[model samples]
Target: MMSNPEKTDLKNLTLPMLERFLQGRGKERFRATQIFKWIYQHDAGSFGEMTNISKDLRTELAETARISKLEPEAVEQGSDGTRKYLFSLGDGNAVESVLIPIEGRNTVCISSQAGCAMGCEFCLTGTFKLVRNLTTAEIVNQIMAIRCDVRAAGEEIRNIVLMGMGEPLHNLDNVIPAIQIMIDGNGLQLSNRRVTVSTCGLVPEMERLGRELPNVNLAVSLNATTDELRDRIMPVNRKYPLKELLRACREFPLPGRRKVTFEYVMMGGINDSLEDAKRLLRLTSDIPGKINLIPFNEHEGCGFRAPTQAAIDAFHTFLIDRNVTVITRDSRGADISAACGQLKGNLENRKEII
Candidate 1:
């Protein structure tokens, strides 16, 4: 079916926004809650599927609103059970998401934009440049589409991470509401702890996110300990240096035992030195969070190489010796170009050549 640009996407609205929308349409605020449950909980494809709602009201909704859904244009599954999904945005642009299944947890990584503007030298998505920020529906539907697959396999998606193709903080306007829908008790019913928003140190937005969604987990893609190196790898660091970024992390309100996760991507011969490890400890000493040491996932055209197992072990050992909680994450879906945006980059290049 052709998309109706004029029609409002009900999936785009948060609970409060939905309430306002219904009220404006001369409907009771309760109608918004019912619609929310029908769309999210019941996965209603159309207003006609909402049997509990009156036929007249359903007809009214059908005339002006549409439930947006994204069907993946392509899906690549790795031997490790990690699946990468490429979804068309209806425009010329497309975005990708990944499903990572661990022992007890099934995490779906969703994207916030068609491509990335943050030119992190190591990231594949940044090579494409920024296409556009995804709408609320586009972001939310990625989770919904993946959740459908996980549930069919008799496993539920326990975690949602905005660590796919784009910087979530860069698209805060759409990302925030999408997150609200994720943790809403009446809808998706995901625990606040299960959802994570990862950013390459967008300082002001980080503070704003902590203020607005204190319960939701925050992860900073802190690939370097020193600003000099970080600025070279992640261009965003040039705007908001380590001092400003770390200050935001330190000041971020952590309700309960929540600590801001520091995601350090350890590149071989780059930021993997013993000196860098020492600087990392000093940088995050006061922050009440753990460290996730990710060995650089080597990809084509990227000169960066993954740190050796010996180097990774040394980095992990140093942190453990200093009473820091750290976990060296094994890179998943290596055979399937599971690194964020790798599959999309390959597909787009093929299309150009074709």
Candidate 2:
């Protein structure tokens, strides 16, 4: 049997790109909006379902472009209502997206690459080695897929955190356009504040992201207070360094009440000391940001343990007493291994089963 020709993915195109594509085809400019609403609002899966569009245009679109929707191969829901979705890619590899529902808030944690290259000592995903960067479609489709699931269950995804498998800033080209589609009022329509891009402190790309999506929230995983400790755990620090990274955080463009979130993962006997807390307070003292103290989640072969409750409490109290804005963001989806820094591209195992 002959394979069909690859159809262009209209869903991958940002509004401006879609408009340009349609305009090049000698079509009206307003069609982009119509098609966007059909795809996003009406949940039009195929061109035939776009009834408001001209028949000829719909036929042309069917022949030339298509929308690629993600179908989760497997889904595991945590007792805490966090669902981890495994999506198969065209390549034999797979990626994971998470749906975390907290009381009234629905958040989707999406990945940017197949595996990670940053090699953070405590993260499970770093063990797989970097495979490939996901395209804009792959990134956006995660939200679209999760959004559909949320709507089906009578809830809607309100927040998106790019804190899944890989470092987003490392894949800036695809990520930027994906961000455009995410915040586009005519498309996903997510507020910039609701969409957050978490990075392992890629200073230059972080700067570029702020310039492009200034309103989008930026979260930095600053797990260690000392450069020496950080360099050991997060190898990215060896290049960016504490001095340079903090400088970037301080000078990062923030309008109104927006503040950069500094994520500090507390490792027992490592970076959770009273002095460590003091160092962290001083390090971010000049920057306009809040702190999220996350206790490490022990994964098999990762050899890290979550800090004791007393230790964790002490760290949180230290920051609060000093009048520093901080919170302890406990891990969710621990039972399903979808918690922060725990996604390990289990697709290899899925491929074996297939």
Candidate 3:
């Protein structure tokens, strides 16, 4: 049987906080940095591996602080080099994160909530009820686990997308701190430019994110072109309509050459019409933006199918013809139910609390 006591997840604690904790325990400040470096930079899984620290200090840390690790219950790899990991948290609550390797960059999709509250009609995650927002440590552990895997494979993760399970803006308190930890040079060391936070048009949080975290990339999941359609598809739109959301995007204070990425998932015969494409072009005309046209990735209970290649191509061309910079995102890990909005976690199916 495991003899571990309930302790703070050290992987979730920031470097400075760790230092303070050590200082409180009458340990030298440098010991904190060393432990931090070992856990984060060297990927030490246990305090016993922190060799530089004295044996007594190591024992103290072992008893006082806990290093969080994800026990991957299941891992599925797609033919297109996308991998999905179903990680079981300490409380048996499970969450899913994916790693997609494209060209030279690997983008890890991180989840902020166990299940999404945003009831976007076509989303697989939205089909399930929101369980609870993930803690900052839980969110950061997903990235750390993937980073460890990348190192073992002699590769590096170049980007991160908060586009996996939940609406990020809804969990801004935890999400914001998690991003800060990722961007911290002493930790994950990911650049803000490479971390994209995707939202379903949470207007107040959108504006606040722009003002507070200026460097992180922002992406709005704008599935429909008009308010009527948007409201029907995304219930959040009923509160923060298209006009207000777009206005927030336009007024977003982005730095040099950093344009907000607008994610448009194409649903076959639903929002894939040329008229919808034109309206999309018009809606985003004045903002500095790039459109990511994602062909819908279907799930078991979700009744939506991806748009045809021809229809997707038409939508891409329509945006580019109007001088809009567009890229059709290749849906990865779809076969394993790990594509966008498809991560509902195994815990849900098991009827377990997450």
Candidate 2 ranges beyond 4 A from true positions: 1-5, 351-354
Q: TM-score per candidate, in order?
A: 0.96, 0.96, 0.93
Q: Tens digits of per-residue lDDT for model 3 on 263-302?
A: 9999998999999999998899999999999899876677
| Residue 163 alpha-carbon offset, candidate 2, angstroms | 0.5
The residue pairs that clash in candidate 2, if any, are none
178: Cα error in model 3, Å: 1.5
Scored by lDDT, model 2 comes in at 0.87
lDDT of 1: 0.87
Which of the two candidates, 1 or 3, achieves a greater TM-score against the reference? 1
| Candidate 3 residue-wise lDDT at 251 | 89
lDDT of 1 by residue, 1-354 (tens): 128979999888999999999999899999899989988888888999888899999999999999989887778888998998877777777777889999958999888887789989988888888888989999889998888898899989899988988889999999999999999976788998999999998999998898899888889999898889989999999999999999999988878888889999889999998899999999999899899998888887899998999999999999999999999887887787775435343326534211
Which regions in candidate 1 have their CA more than 4 angstroms from the true location?
340-347, 350-354
lDDT of each: 0.87, 0.87, 0.85
Stretches off by above 4 angstroms in model 3 are: 1-6, 26-28, 350-354
Backbone clashes, candidate 1: 0
